[model samples]
Target: MRARLMIRYILGEMIPTFFMGVIVFILILLTFQALRLTDYILIHGVKVISVVEMMGFLSTSFLPILFPMSLLFAVVLTYGRLSADAEIVAFRSIGLGMPSIIAPALILSILIGILSLQTSFHIAPWGNRQFELLVTKLGSEKPATIVKEATFSEGFFDRVVYANKVNSKTGALEHVFVYDESTPDNPVTVIAREGRIIQEKTDLGNAASLRLSDGSIHRTSQGRHTKIDFSTYDVSLLDPAEQQFRSKTPPSLTIEELKARMKTKGLKKDERLSLEI
Candidate 1:
């Protein structure tokens, strides 16, 4: 009964410290992420709520790194304070062993380590995949949300957009120039007198469509330029959400799926190496 009470006393001293350590470590790690995420929101024009949601997902992903460190700090700090007060000396004078005094901390560490393993092996990858999906959903917005007037906007559907005037409400644009590099070998530059950006919702996700009026498309290939005029033309932008189902990359896959993949015939050397490591 006395040993159990002593263990409880030690645990009471350590658990609060463990939680505090976790909060401090998480805040320190998240500070750098907060700065980068803030920049992403400002540059991409993403909503604050959406950014907050992403941060929540990121916090979950960081647990595997935080847990063990927090437990260690809690154990070290609690024992150090107890030692400073001569608690260890008093316990030793009474014939209690060093291991007896430290047993509570060891048990707590073991429990925390088990939980941390679950976070590392199971939860982290799932959170990462969700984070990626959120990014994809945010990127599928209309060019009007992304483009600043009279400035070159690159990375939209792997094309560059420059518009003299923009109507954010209607997604309308004027004097628009778009350079399409989707086909690296055959590049195309389009100039439009007027254009509008449209977002279509499909079963997959949002898709960006550029509707240009009174435009001329200049295609270049093999040192030759072919120009064509059109009254109206529509072009599709890169949809990040569309790539979600193409393949289950290793990072997005669970342990079960990886084990199943290992059983597949003719697994490449790289695949075998990745699974092994």
Candidate 2:
């Protein structure tokens, strides 16, 4: 009963300190993170709420690293205070073993380590993927804002668009040029006298459409070029970043997925070894 009481006493002192340390560490990290995120928001004219949401996602991803450091700080602070108060000497005088003194910390460390492993391998990766999806959604929602006058905009998938003049308020473009490379072997280019952007809600999601007037489409394949003129044309815009987010690498896979992958065939020996490690 006395041993259990001693362990409980140690934990009672340590738990509050551990939480305080976690708060301090997270604040310090956010201070540096806010500087960069603020700069990005200002330069890109992004919404403040979006930035805040992004920060929350990033903070979630950092829990694995923060948990261990916070626990260490709590251990050091708690033991240092006890040492200063001569508690160690008093405990030794009572014939209590060093293992008994250290047992509580050891058990807590193991528990925290297990939790950290779950966070690092599963939660962190999920947060990272969510962050990428948020970026893609933000960019896709404002396709016109991403384009600039007299600049080659590569925001659209497999296409580059340029406008000699742009009216930001009206989402209108003058003297536009677009190079489309949707097909690897064949390419198309379009030149238009005027154009406008249209954002529409579709079943899949938000979609961007560019409507061009008095444009000529030029298609080239196998060293042959065909040209056609049209009174007006409309093309859909796709966000390439969405594709990248969808095809994340192994680091984004959860612990369960990794185990399943290990059982699958056609994995290289090195790949299986790396996963095992």
Candidate 3:
């Protein structure tokens, strides 16, 4: 009965401290992420609800690291307090051996280890993938967030865009200029009086549509010059970041996926190393 009571008492002390430590450590790790997410709201004009969802995904990613650190902190603090109060001495004096006193902490550590293993293998990877997908969706859905006014922006694939003024509320661009090198042999240049960004869902994925009014297309190829004037024109806007994100396997693949990838033939040294890591 005394042994059971001792075990229960030790657990009662450790469980609350463990949870508190997890909260404190997770907050510490998430501070920088929160600041970055704040930029998405303030600068990129992302919705608060989306930012909150991003934070939730990020918190799950932090759990694998935070769990072990928090467990260690809880153990050290709880035991240090008990030792300072001479509880350890009193327990030893009451015929409890060192192993008996340490058993409860050991059991708690094992439980935490099991939880941390599951988080590292499964939960964290899923969270990371979700975060990446969300960011990509945001970038594709709101192309204005990627393009800044009065600057040459090259984030769009195979194209450089410049806008003298951008209307945040309506996503309208004034005095828009685009240099398109999507065709290597013949390059095209477009200048427009007014333009707006539109998003469309296609079979492949979400695509950005840059609609221009009162624009002219200029092309030069094989020592020949061609110019065409138009009332309206549409240019496809593809962000390179989104393309790259789609092409590469996310760094946080589950352990099973990593193992399968490692078994593939003709793997590059760097890719194999990354998978192993």
Error of 1 at 242 (Å): 4.9
TM-score of each: 0.68, 0.66, 0.72
Ten contiguous residues minimizing lDDT sum, candidate 1: 238-247
Candidate 1, 1-277: lDDT as tens digits: 6567778889999999999998999788889898768866776678899998888778778888899889989999999999999987887787778788989999998899888887877897788778877765787764576777999987665579999998876889999999987666798999999999988877766787889999899998999989999999998764546667644557666778778888999887877887766
Best by TM-score, which number? 3
Candidate 1 wrong stretches, greater than 4 Å: 142-198, 209-246, 265-267, 271-277
lDDT tens readout by residue for model 3, 159-248: 788999987667899999999876667999999999999877776678777899998999999999999999999886664436545543
Better of 1 and 3 by TM-score: 3
Cα RMSD to the true fold for all candidates: 5.6, 5.9, 6.3
Off by more than 4 A, model 3: 148-198, 201-206, 209-248
Tell how far residue 59 is off in model 3, in angstroms: 0.5
